[model samples]
Target chain A: MKIDKQKFPDTDGFFGEYGGKFVPETLMYALEELEDTYSKLKDSEDFKKEFYADLSDFVGRPSPLYYADRLTKHYKSGKIWLKREDLNHTGAHKINNTVGQILLAKYMGKKRIIAETGAGQHGVATATVAARLGLECHIYMGAEDVKRQSLNVYRIKLLGAHVHAVDSGTATLKDALNEALRDWVTNVDDTYYIIGSVTGPHPYPMIVRDFNSVVGFELIDQSKALFGRMPDAIIACVGGGSNAMGAFYPFIDKKETRLIGVEAGGNGVSTGEHAAPLNDGSPGVLHGARSYLMQDEVGQVKDTKSVSAGLDYPGVGPEHSWLKDIGRAEYVAINDQEALDAFHTVTKLEGIMPALETAHAFAYLDHLPKDFDESTNIIVNVSGRGDKDINTVAEIDGIKF
Target chain B: MNRLRKKLDHLISIKEKALVAYLVAGDPDLDSTLDLMHLFVKSGVDIIEVGVPFTDPIAEGPIIQKAHDRALKNNISLPNIIKLVEDFRKVDDSTPIILMGYLNTFSFHKELIDKSDQHGVDAVLVVDIPGELSISSYGISNPNIDSISLISPTTSQERIEKIAKNGSGFIYYVTLRGVTGSSNLDVEEINSNIKKIRSYSDIPTLAGFGIKSNEDARLLSEYSDGIIVGSSIVDMITKQSESRNFDRIGEYLRGLKNAIL
Candidate 1:
């Protein structure tokens, strides 16, 4: 089945059977307005020039695709290359989407910007862009995440954005998302919701994916320039599937490069505590989009536990669901312990302290197919830095300070 | 005809405003909810909107969200709520019952929704799948069960026409620009939007969201066919959950009902 990667989310915003405008009537107009305006601006030369210039100058774009010599030797199978999205401004690929969205907010003449965050990387990125653009920004994060990722919270606050600590329903990513949606519903007229991932209703998943696809497009150029060919496989972590979708979108039609999305496996999938929705959950409507969600028999979203806050969500992006259903991409999970080990190993081997979310992708190196040899070239997306996760790692290591 | 349509027509013929009372089923327990349903009809509630508790009620405010959380914590399921409606029908069959909830709960239990009419449910108001996307879109094609749709202050004229045309039973006109339980009733806005909705279709438009106080009910009922009070009533149920004495809730319901009449 040759799927047209470009002709997705057909007008009504459905990626196959997933992704639709499953929101309240109040938000329908706002989404339609956004859709209309985005359609006009997305292809305009002015929009492209402004967006690319900002990406190059502000975000330090074209983040190097460095060959991981030590890690490749350690793996003794695939030649590992790292797409260093971690090197971008604000220390994550989150800035890439935020920059693009805040630009859209500016063009739309929205006075306020609201977003939901899990790891606080996206929160920090949104705050950074909102500050630069001089827009009123509010970021909703789970109360639990506020404590775990305190550094990023402080960074968001320092960047002049208000942080709302949502204490409802496990007080994590999904709950934060619910709170953010409520805020959007209330302030739909003057506010622009900068959804941090490729999830949510209609144009949001499409918009976020398009903005972040720069990562994959750049990888295509860098791989050809350095390795003389496309990668054998591309791996990235999926939490609402922003970075992975960004890295995989450009290669969906390129069948030679295998796309793999690593989900957080908390204890394990069998424990019913992990956040790997595509791997373990069923198809259901959640957070305004029909996607794979970790829900129970009665359709109540189940609680998900993960060491990484970013990957601790019960849902993934809808496009990933479509990709998985079509067998265009492979979905897998990495347990917390394995991710932690990879965090330490990657830091020691490559001197690159990967975020726990990013570490999940690196951890999959050990599980690569035995057929992969030195001739196989694999690129893993370092989606974010670990500076925000230092405290979490320290507590797990029993180092209180 | 569905009970909801028949009741709405009867109310309109008599020039009496409809009072739609909303409560979370199984908040205290399903038995209490059944009792409350009886009590609401006794207090002149023309219709009953039973909230089917979901894990995430995004369109709800803190009051109703908490009510949903409480009901869910009590281990309430769609089947349990459907059974509650069945039990309610054993005593009272005149007051139309509408299952109000997010789409996931109803979509997940298509079998239950398929037989909801026989079980005494007249309509379903799914918060997520609004407009042209009805309960039938989920494959639960029960012609006897009406799919209620919402029209808000932010809804455009074009959308109002589409939503009002697609909807059945009643057009829920959200009184405010916010979620359920949000404050500030724009009477003029409500009048205009409801009039706009009525222009599109003859379906009865009921004003809801932030409809507290008899004055709000009186003012909103002047424009629309009826008023739907949710958060304030849910708040009352939460306060009186311990004693299970719903006298104040009944009094409040009667107060709004009299104001509308």
Candidate 2:
């Protein structure tokens, strides 16, 4: 499908009927300030030079696009390649966005940085950038997530960022987000909120998507250098839909490339315990954006369950909602067991441990259309490394360590 | 004119300040909320802002957020709150009741908004969707119920013009740069911003958020037409939930009213 990327999120920051600035009046000035600064800086060559230089020198950009030969053979149907965002600094694709936003904060003369995290990768990434920039940083993580992802919490604290353990409303990503927003509202003047996904109100979804689109842009060059054409399909997991939107943005206009977003099916979609909003949820307003959300009949957001902490969100990005409605991309879900099996399979076969979030995309390979042959080249976004999820995997395996 | 405009006009004509008190409906239960509504009027509160409980109230502080949680625990929905308002109207016909909440809870129950006038709901203050976007943006075609728009300290001069011009009932001037219960209200900043809003439109401005003490209400109402007390009142209700002894609440409201007078 020939989707126009620039046309979306109109001046008021909407994508079709979704993605408006549904925040309190207090944050409007800051959002407008950010939008103005970003508009001038996004096209400035000086800004691009600085941004790309940091990506190359600081974040270790051009993260390798490697072909997973063993995984392809295991699948026995099509060629599989991985966008090795795990190779980036901070060991996740989240740094791409943090690196960009930290620079934005600096440009906007903000001295403090605040972020909300679910799996801790984004928190670690934001902390890493804030440390380098010498900005006061605070990260809000759900109390449950703080306990689950303790290593990342320690790392963030070690990097001089304060971690506020939020214990409200399901005490997960959504709650953490609510706390971060409250903090931002409280300290709007000095604090710049670095939202870690393609969620939240306008400009954020657009900004995060633009920063992370380096993944797809790099893949375009790498694919041509290797396979001489775009991949037949691109797969990435959708939590708040940042990574998937990044991978899919550059290919939206390319008719030949198929975009597939995989969501975490904790138990199953029918069981209503999953985080697959696009697959099983309805359109509603949450977190300042109108999107498909796991909400009840009365519009209260539902608590979502997922083995991957990063994928446990009640809502998807509004752009993904638009893409789904327009039939520009396909969204599917993979259960916890299937994602776990895929994690183990890829680690054994390819000698690479993918993040639980990324494993969802890899798990979808088993459910691919039967018509795909050996010539078909599929690229999956390996969003992060699995070191943070080692304890989760161990607990499930009944290992004390 | 609607009941809200009439009440505010009457207050302005008499050179009296409006004391608007906010309480989450069904915090302890719906019957207590009704009793509290009558108490607010009896204690000389000029207007009552009934908080419609929502799951995630991002604009609220811990006190109001906890109140929402307590209300939701009792399965409090928007329709139930509207019904509560209907029940309130059966006894008190003149006092203007405004439903304040997040956008989704009210937007999802558009049918109630359409009939809000019949149920004696004079206004709705949706915290999330402000300015150019109103309840009509969500497909609620009700012309009777006033849409109260908020103007914060951070609002630009240009936006003040837009919001002030578009808003009805009154301009909700967020006194501080924070959530409901945040402190450190810059009186000078609030005064200047309220003046700027008045320069744009003739709507009555009500300063809310962070107005805790009667002194705070007295000082803020000196600049604007009225003052709205939210988190502080909600906090009192939560603390008094066990005792059901709301005389203290009534005392606080009376103090605020007298201070503003």
Q: Which candidate comes out best when scored by lDDT?
A: 1
Candidate DockQ values, in order, are: 0.87, 0.85
Model 1: docking quality category: high
lDDT of 2 at A97: 96
Task: Give the winner by DockQ.
Answer: 1
| Per-residue alpha-carbon lDDT of candidate 1 for residues B1-261, written as tens digits (9 for 90 to 100) | 989999999999999999999999998888889889999998889999999999999999999889888888899999888889889888888789999998888889998899989999999999998676788888988889999988888888888889889899998988877889989887888888888888889889888899889998999889989999999988989899999999998899989999998
Worst 10 residues of 2 chain A by lDDT: A1-10
In candidate 1, list every pair of residues with a backbone clash.
none
List clashing residue pairs in candidate 2: none
Per-model TM-score of chain B: 0.98, 0.98
What's candidate 1's i-RMS value?
A: 0.8
Off by over 4 Å in 2: none
Question: Tell me, what's the RMSD of every candidate?
Answer: 0.8, 0.9
Model 1's TM-score against the true structure = 0.99
**After superposing candidate 1, which stretches have Cα over 4 Å from the reference?**
none
Q: Please provide, for model 1 over A225-319, each residue's C-alpha lDDT reduced to its tens digit, 9 standing for 90 to 100.
A: 99899999999999999999999999999999999999999999889889999999999999899999999999999999999999999999999
lDDT of 2 by residue, A326-368 (tens): 9899999999999999889988998899999999999999998
